[model samples]
Target: MSTTPSTTPEVRDDSRPARIGIQLQPQHAQYPAIRAAAARVEEMGADIAFNWDHFYPLYGEPEGLHFECWTMLAAWAEATSRIEIGALVSCNSYRNPELLADMARTVDHISAHDAGTGRLVLGIGSGWFEKDYDEYGYEFGTAGGRLDKLRDDLPRIESRLGALNPAPTRKIPVLIGGGGEKKTLRLVAKHADIWHTFGDVETFTRKSAVLDERCAEIGRDPGEIERSVGVETVQDAETMFAAGARLFTIGVGGPDYDTAVLADLLAWRDDKNA
Candidate 1:
């Protein structure tokens, strides 16, 4: 399989003010609420929608209501038309790199067939949730070890796509989430088309500078990698954007998935496009 960039058509608008993606957190929500929230986000003009691949909620209650990631994305792909869908960061430890590539490819096909848009931006990260590993019978190792595995596996994952019987109609964009400067950022500079970090404007600004330095060392242009950040409140949106965060993600938990807060974000996105 050739490692060169696939000839798939570029389907995203790179000029837009980054993009506003919502993480449909698998917690405190039910199926209907999650489904409705996806629809509302699409209606409100969100560019992308996402869910995390975890067995439990990351916040609120430890064992709160939750849903699985890939399964939910398959549903969201069918539920909405105009918004891209994916996991905020699928854990690299859960599945084999080849299998994961196939899964992502299948989802890409589903999104294209259902919505007429093959927009599956895969946001992947080194495994973190210890509870998930314990419950799933996987080993819980040091953070460095996990990241090493990810670095080793990413290229294989990319290569596997070419080996698949029917190639994905699009080359799914790979978004690597995490801000560890030494290891993670280097991996981002080398492999990621998008890099997602968590923090306020000041934090993102600092880390982004480090990322740029790493990019230089790797002979990669920092501008080539899209910078993304998670927004818990609307007020931080403009602040982060000004700090060089083009991709802003808002997380909405389940059960009562409300999109009221997303209205401001969508409006902001539209303003930029307009």
Candidate 2:
């Protein structure tokens, strides 16, 4: 793999047009409703469609209707023709890394059949959410412990992907999500092709500087990892882009997944690209 020196922002193609993603929160909705929303987002020209991984609703009623992440992604692989589909961040603690790799590979083939490119971004993170552990019978380990596990498992996931009988259509892009200044940022420098985080201009700038330090220490280029942020409004997208974010995602929940918010963001994306 190629690495970029930290001294320059020119390591990767900064000229690539800004891309928009929509996180269709899979909570408090029926399967068909979620399916329709997924199709709608792709039709509206989203570059990526994301669903989060969690067993129950993260907001509103604790017992709200929700669907599993990877299963829905497999369905999305068939339902949408253009948009890239995957979890915003899959919890690495939920499944063995090898199994997760196989699952991603299968979805790659499914999505590749729809669009020639196998559009699976393996967005992963050290697991959080105590309820997911308590109810699911996973060990509720310390955050540091979980991060350690993630560090150990990533290589295994990659090896498994390479060893599969019919290999993944393409090398699945690894997207690491978190904002920890120490371990997380260092891991992002070493492993991730995309790094997703949440912050305003100053926070993003500070964390990005730290990321640059981490990348430089390892002889990798900071620009090689795409910077992504969650945006709530057009102004938010603009601010993040100015702070060096190129991939912007907005989250919408169901019951009624509104496209108006997405429309505004997409228009902003068009203006930026133009």
Query: Which stretches in model 1 have alpha-carbon errors above 4 Å?
Result: 1-16, 114-117
How well is each residue in 1-274 modelled by candidate 2, as lDDT tens digits?
2233232222233565788999999999999999999999999999999999999999999998999999999999988878898898999999999999999999999999843779898999998989989999999889999999999999899899999978888888898999887799989999999999997777776777778789989999788889989999998988778768899999999889998989998998898898
TM-score of 1: 0.90
The most accurate candidate by TM-score is 2
> Residue by residue across 1-274, what tens digits does model 1's lDDT show?
2223232322232353658988888788778888888888888778889899999889999988888898888888777767898898999999999999998888888888753557788889998899999998988799999999999999999999888977887878999999997899999999898999997666677677777788888789788889888886666877776667778888878677777778887777667557
Clashing pairs in 1: 28-254, 29-254, 29-255, 30-255
Q: Candidate 2, which segments miss by more than 4 Å at Cα?
A: 1-13
